[model samples]
Target: MTDGSIQQTRLPTRTVVLHIGRHKTGSSSIQATLRHNQAQLLQRGVLVPKNLPPNLSGFFSHVFSRAPEALKFNVERGHGRQQAQKHGNRLLERLAHELEAFTGNRIVLSGEEACALHPDEVAQVRDRLGPVLAPAGQQVDFRVLLYTRDPVAYASSAMQQNIKKNVKLLEDHKPVVLRKAPGWYQRTHAAWAGVFGADAVEFRSFETACAAPGGLIGDFLTAAGIPPEGIEPQRANDSIADEIAGFLSSSHVPKLPPDQRGLWSAGFDLSTADQEILFAIRGSKGGLLTASEQAGLWDAVAADMRFIEREFGITYGAAQTAGAVPFGPVFMDDLKAALPRLSPPVRRGLLAYLRDRSAPGDPGQLQPEGI
Candidate 1:
């Protein structure tokens, strides 16, 4: 689908819904739901692309066009700016073609990476599509949906994912995350609003949406103007269990050099019993936030949360301002009960780690804001 193949044909009037993500907000789940219900949605006059990248879970999957430079080069096959823009223009052409042929009243194009697009890139998107969707008697609306989460929770989840990707412990990489954490949720949404009219932007709290009647998927369908009846929600990208998360946070497995880490993980084995024990400890541990740390992070994002609530007319669990307190010292009784399942080395490591981390940290130590 090159730029040359697409003609500058005017598309029929329709509602364009763009889901720009603040990541770690269950965008994956939403995308999966959208894919699963593509047929039903089309039947209901909501057209969506049938061939989105399943692996990336993105509506459009050209790395050069969709990702930022640093991410594109480091994570994907590196391409120059000219190449990216060229490819992006091609994608817009395809999008225009799809819209031109679409008979539906609504068309949805969802991609989390779109949230990272520069203003100019966004302008390119609008300009490229604007001609294709010019007013045609029927109303033409361009709307963007953005889902936000609490800063601490989002960061904690992002940290978990980052560690999973690279061979790095939480401590080794957390400093960078805390220092450059994405606290600009408000700014990001504002950028989209500026480009696509304030009235055109739809802001929703991921937490609140997840807690809604049908959970995240249900709430997203409702937001997408899809009826939720008969839709079976499937959870995607499930997080590692809390105790295992804690172990991974402290362990050097992911922190090993790339080669060694791969080999270690490949050869490493865990018993069914140990796996069960670890799974049992799920929800026992959360983000490494002390009572004070949680409160501080919450306060830092208080303004952002307030802005979202005021602008979107929705509450994002205001009552739950603080994250759960960090786990207290390991209970010897519980530890003893679980010792039979763990390998000797793991058992010893857990004992030492727990013993050493029993005491509360120094209150004077610097902590990242809004993390």
Candidate 2:
């Protein structure tokens, strides 16, 4: 029989707060705040892991996604199966090492990709975590935090977020596949709950979180059992306006002269000045999507919406709040009005793209997807 002292020497329960964002629920902001205040949180026994793969945002997708081979990080570099598995193994090792070294009682792993994981994937991660802790005789308790938005709003925000990264060469002027509905809330969430147990998973309302004390970051930290004091909230919105997103995918890019047209052929990082200038290209203040499109999209997501309401009493605002508005003829007019505010090169490039695109046979014709 083992000595009673061995049992007494076991490590105290370590609580891991897994913030699996359902996207566009201020996940960027929460991550930013958590990362920015890392030192302060560490003092209070809460940890935002400092050592892990560089882009931890994609960590879950790299490891748990059904199609790891197709990831941009993999495909762009021509990395395949072996590289992906190696990366996954490395991440698991890093996590185990970090947990072993941390002085803190609570660790926060914030990544929206976790919300996208399938059931088997969830089980895989859960199983790995336990074994990693087994060797050290450490017990772990998980608190899974998810923020669910109104399905219609999520679809709109998610699509525009996709447009921000699309290079013309990689995709046509449409979302690869429009999410006809919101996330499979019932299926995927239940999967997470099953893996971690229902009490560990707290699917909160995005709308309610926003109205809380320090807003989303506060609500998240509270749910995670971290002290919310002295941690400043931060916001990170990298998305372009829907109109600009629509414009990028419209037939106009195909119309540009070879010199100007090549801009869309590859992806490159924008300097802060250029990025801010790009953000200036805002869509209509009145909002551009038609009522009919909104209605149909709602019809598609209504069942998921009802499931959340019935199960979690989750009310994610209304469908009319947001939806993707494709490029209509009016979008060109909006761009023209904003031209005086644009820098010379951007103005010239857009004008040239427009020149060839406008034809007598197809005046102001646009071909954005999800029309």
TM-score of every model? Answer: 0.72, 0.77
What's the residue-level lDDT of 337 in candidate 2? 59
Span of ten consecutive residues with least summed lDDT in model 1: 362-371
Tens digit of per-residue lDDT, candidate 2, span 1-371:
47898887878887877888877888888888888888898889877777763226677777667677777777767889789767777877777777676676777888887877878889876877666643456678888888887655565566566556545421332233234354477776788998999888888898788887678888888888877878887778756665555445544332344565333343433345544565666653223234665666567667787888887788644437333333345555566555666656655555655444443454445333211
What would you estimate as the lDDT of candidate 2?
0.66
- Model 1, global lDDT: 0.61
Clashing pairs in 2: none
Backbone clash numbers for all candidates listed: 1, 0
Off by over 4 Å in 2: 1-10, 53-55, 65-67, 133-135, 167-183, 252-275, 281-289, 317-345, 348-371
lDDT of each structure? 0.61, 0.66
